[model samples]
Target: MRPFPLLLVLLASASLSAADVTPPKGETPPPATDLLGNPTDVPTVSKEEAAVLVVQGKEAMIESNDNPRRSVDAAVAFSKALKYYETTGDTDTICDLEANIFWCKKRMNLDDVKSFVAQKSGDKTVVAALAKVDKVANKEVTADKADEYFSRAEKFASKNPENFEQISVRYFEVAERFVGTEVGIKAQKLSLVAQQNQMKAIKEAQDAQRETLFSKPTKLNGKIQQTAVPSTDTQKSSASSIRTLYKSDFAKRKPNQKQNLLNKLMDQARTTKDDPVMLHALLTAATDLAMECQDFYAVISASDLMAMNFSGVDATAQKKTAFGKSKNPTVLAIIKLLDNPEDGDANTIVGKYFCYEAQKWDLGIPLLMHGTDADMKSLGDMEQLKPDGVAQQIELGDKWYDIGKKGRKGQPTLEGPMGRALYWYQLAEPKITGISKDRIAKRMDEIDSLLPMTNLNYESLTAKQWDRLKGGMAVISAAKDRNDIGLRLTAGKKYRIVPHPTDTWQPTTYYSSGNSRSVNWKGESLTNTPNTRQFIYFTGGDFKEGAMVMQIENGKWMKPGLVEGDGRLWLGPFSDYAWGAGGKGEIRIKILPADDE
Candidate 1:
């Protein structure tokens, strides 16, 4: 007879809150927005005015250092100060402002600070800020009653080793309370050991009881005869085999070990007449191994088994009970096990399979993005996809779009989570090539059209409103025809203009003083001539190329009527290509976000 009915126990006890790993929450930061939560636009300021704003912003930042609650106000002040100082390229001042902003954002528990720093890549100021936050995050926190907890655990394990349930709970408490620390990690391992030992003891006891009952002989008919009893040795073996499969170290094993083990599991499950206990265990073990190994084929094979045996979650009490008797009684146990903390690669494996093969977008996004970001940073290059980074990004982008589309269909809210799709697409665009590049580019435009853009009162705005418009805001010309109206400002400020991709250009052909017939300025010295009217020109580089519209900023001048009189200029900071003509209706401009490139 099998030694005893094997009791396989899978324990998941340690968990960390999302907040633990997030940005700082220093003291108490100021509010994210004004009391009404509405942002005001920042208007163009003179050099003197800009200086005054910077000084005032610095004062607020100084005050914020002592009172964390003032961080929000400091952030706001620094942001506005940046809007002015950026025009002058004040490197020192800009660094100070960015640092303050990062600190405040961290203290507020905002994640965007990291994203902002990530965009800058090599900027020393933002990089230092990021380092500071990381240092704080890694700093040790004093655990309350850590020794007491450990003592209690020792006492419990020694006194009630047979009480597996209570023992597991105590160990789990210790593990959870001290996660990320040396003591906590050790406790977690010990908890697993305790659970396994207790389970083995129970199985042995049951086996002994069965043997005693079976060993008793019964007399039959005239002659005394021994009883022939059926054996459950096969069932016991199946359970034991599954446990061994889960615990085996894949790294030291032969390449064929996976296939061999899978075949063995299948044979055992089949020989047992597809018993739920054996089959479920087979599925769970395969999944855990597949994730641990980061083996694509194994993952696929395991997925097939999961579908064939478990199928999906049970909805009824009766069905739930039936599944509970199986090796992985609950679906959660299988998933939770696959998400092992020790295996850094498992998440990507799990995420990729879920998104691409299983079509589980909800579970795939967070893991996939996290893995992709980690890989990108570790690899140290924007275009580098040393492994599967690019592929994952592409797939993640597709899933995000699909999810966003679903959200839009379900509600009328502007925050349909659709923007995430575009965000991922943009991230993947620079890393991919060929057909994928074309596909992503086309999809980006299509999605942009679908998204709503906020049209600011560009004629007059506060620094707050301008900052808000930096990433996704736009402006439309109210006039039926193009007009010479645009942002008016003092000279010396530099601005990068970006015409809308689909905007209408007055002339279909490229223009120069030698070939300006379209604008009726042919034969005039428009190119490199002092007498010719100054103009804004656009051509070449990635993204749409054309002199679509003329914009006025910081006193710069453009040729008379190049656009169809739209009365507003659509522009972006850090555009790849564009040149502004100096003097005569000149407009000064500043690129906000300081041109990530």
Candidate 2:
């Protein structure tokens, strides 16, 4: 049961009472006739009977109290009374009865009252109205009719300037209905104008009301008094205000001003130990501003202080993990650079650590350029001076690979060294040719084989591989393969995909689905199943289910297909609906850039 507003009930009652006017006492009632005043076979009721039925319908409606099931009963009674009034040509009573029936049906959630009445009375007017409604509901905008539709909407908008809401909706509808058409493009622009106008009108009204409210004086104890307004300057010394200034104003200041600000902020942080909010804010401002200013010494100092004193539950832990504590020579050298940014020996050690160990080229290359290591510094200088020189890039890659191989000792491949080598090689891959390309490919394969195959680890890996060069192998875990891989595919760029020999997975112990590139389900090919659309291609026949599938950004899933449109790549087992749920084992895939067509 849905309760209606009291106003609706009163209106319904008023209509009922006005239409239920009793015939003058002892006056003879007019003979029954059809709407056209012609003889008809339609059933008619006496005036007394009609009156009784109306009373009964009203009673039923009152008792219904907006309950859906009870309202149906009221609708039936009103419908019968409506028929009698229709046959007797009592237009006023007929209209009232129809309204009551409509209301009852409306309460029961039956909104197609026009069709219901049209069918019941066979009224041409009601039928015409229903047909018009159906036409609008089923309207389709095509190139032929797009202009006409746009013109009509424009005309309506011109006629009703104040009704911007409806005008906006109408224009937007035209835009959506005929997308890609000229009218649609025009409509979209007009729709934005109408929406802006609507917002402007609403804002103007609100501003006027606000001004009136604040401008008017209030009476207190028969005396007019002014309202007190809060001052913005009161919050100037707040921690949030400090943070806001750091973000919005810090960068615009001169270098010496920046230094002064950083010193003042650090002093405040050191002194305001009791106020954790202010302390954290001041330290954060100093640290971030120093980082932006490339004052590594200040950054290290402020960060260490914050780490020691921050009271946040996870702050210390997070800082410790990010700025790891170690006695390693490389770490100590990096620490030395904090005291003197120009220390060549320390920079050399720190640069190799970032390049060969951390595999963060963005952080490592600049340091390498400043370091004393002749070969590493030369490569870094070449990268900065001639970034697109393929031969130099390849030579640099060879240096890294050779050094990584030598550094391995008796252990497995050094991930950082090998990753750095791979990064340089990949940068040179698209341009190198013949034996050089084959050599690089072989080296990459060897590196890929030596690297451990494991699920994508967010803690140690990045979401996209366009920057970092960890390895060639991308591990697709059966448990969580829906995640996007680091590989980004450009539109129409060909890529060579090679599955690792160990690329095999099973949906369950009972179902061993060979390799991820090809899989079988019982005797029937799961690829033939219509449910395959849910996994990959909307048209499913191209690729097998349970095979490796790729999605382009948030677009449709499909086979890797080598040459894909521009988007990030994702690899996963193709399973319909279940989507590799409860699957075991992992898929290792190697994606390489192919020569451009």
TM-score of each: 0.19, 0.29
lDDT of 1 by residue, 1-597 (tens): 112111222224222222333335663222232322212232334554455445544444334433343444445445555555666777655544554444444444333344443454533433332333333223344697666666777676788777554455466556655777776787777777766776687667644332211122322223222122213675467656667665653333654465456555555544443256566566556545544444433444444434444434221332223233334222333243233422334444544444444334444444444353464223222212212245666665675566566544323222233444555654455457668879887777666666544322232222233343453333422222233334433443333432222222223223331222222111111222211122223323422222223444322334222222223443321112343121121122223321111
lDDT of 2 by residue, 161-215 (tens): 8866556656765776688888899998887887778668766764433221112
What lDDT is reached at residue 250 by model 1?
37
Q: What pairs collide in candidate 2?
A: 491-566
Show model 1 residue runs off by greater than 4 Å.
Answer: 1-389, 408-415, 454-498, 501-597
Give the C-alpha miss distance for residue 131 in model 2, angstroms: 64
Worst 10 residues of 1 by lDDT: 523-532
* Per-prediction tally of clashes: 29, 1
